[model samples]
Target: MGDKIVIDARGSSCPGPIVELAKAYRNSKVGDTLELWATDAGVRADVQAWAQKTKNQIDSITEQEGKIVVVIKILNR
Candidate 1:
């Protein structure tokens, strides 16, 4: 099955948005798309690190309405 997960963590603090992204990872599979929206300035670094640790592929990073939007493509482990 195909699926997409979007986590809106805008207004959250450090680690909060990253945590949500991690949670989304648990339920996601290879080829899945997970979009994370975070307002915390640290989210970009944190999420990138997390994806590196977990072997996920970062598809894109964009800024939307003052929030950082990250789209991660789940990679096969």
Candidate 2:
């Protein structure tokens, strides 16, 4: 319920969003939730898979006006 870290990756291509998320994850504390905004359509699936692979928790994913918003909680490190 704290202030979530928001990474604006809008207008970025595939991997860009995930990269930003990764960087933010590294700097984030455990249990912190991150919001990633991406314009790429593939970022949703890519981020989900990355989160799963890394053992992170995906809180939710929302799409609005050609942008995808992914809420991910840092977990398991």
Candidate 3:
């Protein structure tokens, strides 16, 4: 995998995080990676659902000092 694209949608809530992710995902290709840092806790579930829907892979989702750090790998598109 190449370097990851970081999406820092920290303060945004609800669809904000997902929207940013979607945009990045749309521009990304298979094998491209993304690192998202969100403050909204709902991002975890949102990312999970998006990943499933898009047929992508969630490499990891960890909490670091209240920040939800999500690592996703584009598996298909």
Candidate 4:
């Protein structure tokens, strides 16, 4: 396991959340967990597709208050 990183993209729209995710992923290591917080509704699907494309694992996707919380387990594969 590595570290837990939180990328906040609250109030951001469309590709903003996904973009932040990719940038973090580029510097992340396998076994690391990334917790992303976003306010964009599109993030739910965007993150899912990104995880699938990158072969990473999504630990959880939940809604808190008005934000979407996504936990991604890095695979680096």
In candidate 3 the C-alpha lDDT for residue 58 amounts to 96
Candidate topping TM-score = 4
* Superposed Cα deviation of residue 62, candidate 3 (Å): 0.4
**Between candidates 1 and 4, the lDDT winner:** 4
Between candidates 3 and 4, name the one with more favorable lDDT: 4
Candidate 3: where is the Cα deviation over 4 Å?
none
Q: What is the lDDT of residue 49 in candidate 2?
A: 92
lDDT of each: 0.85, 0.86, 0.90, 0.91
Residue 22 local lDDT, model 1: 74
Worst 10 residues of 3 by lDDT: 13-22
For candidate 4, list the clashing residue pairs, or say none: none
For residues 1-77, what per-residue lDDT tens digits would candidate 3 score against the true structure? 56689999999975688999989888988888899999999899999999899899999999989998999998888
Q: Which prediction has more favorable TM-score, 1 or 4? A: 4
Q: Give the runs in model 2 whose Cα sits over 4 Å from its true position.
A: 1-3
Say which candidate scores most in lDDT: 4
**lDDT string, candidate 1, 1-77, tens digits:** 55788999988785588888878788888888899998888888987898889888898999968989999888854
Winner on TM-score (2 vs 4): 4
The residue-level lDDT of candidate 4 at 65 comes to: 94
The order by descending lDDT is: 4, 3, 2, 1
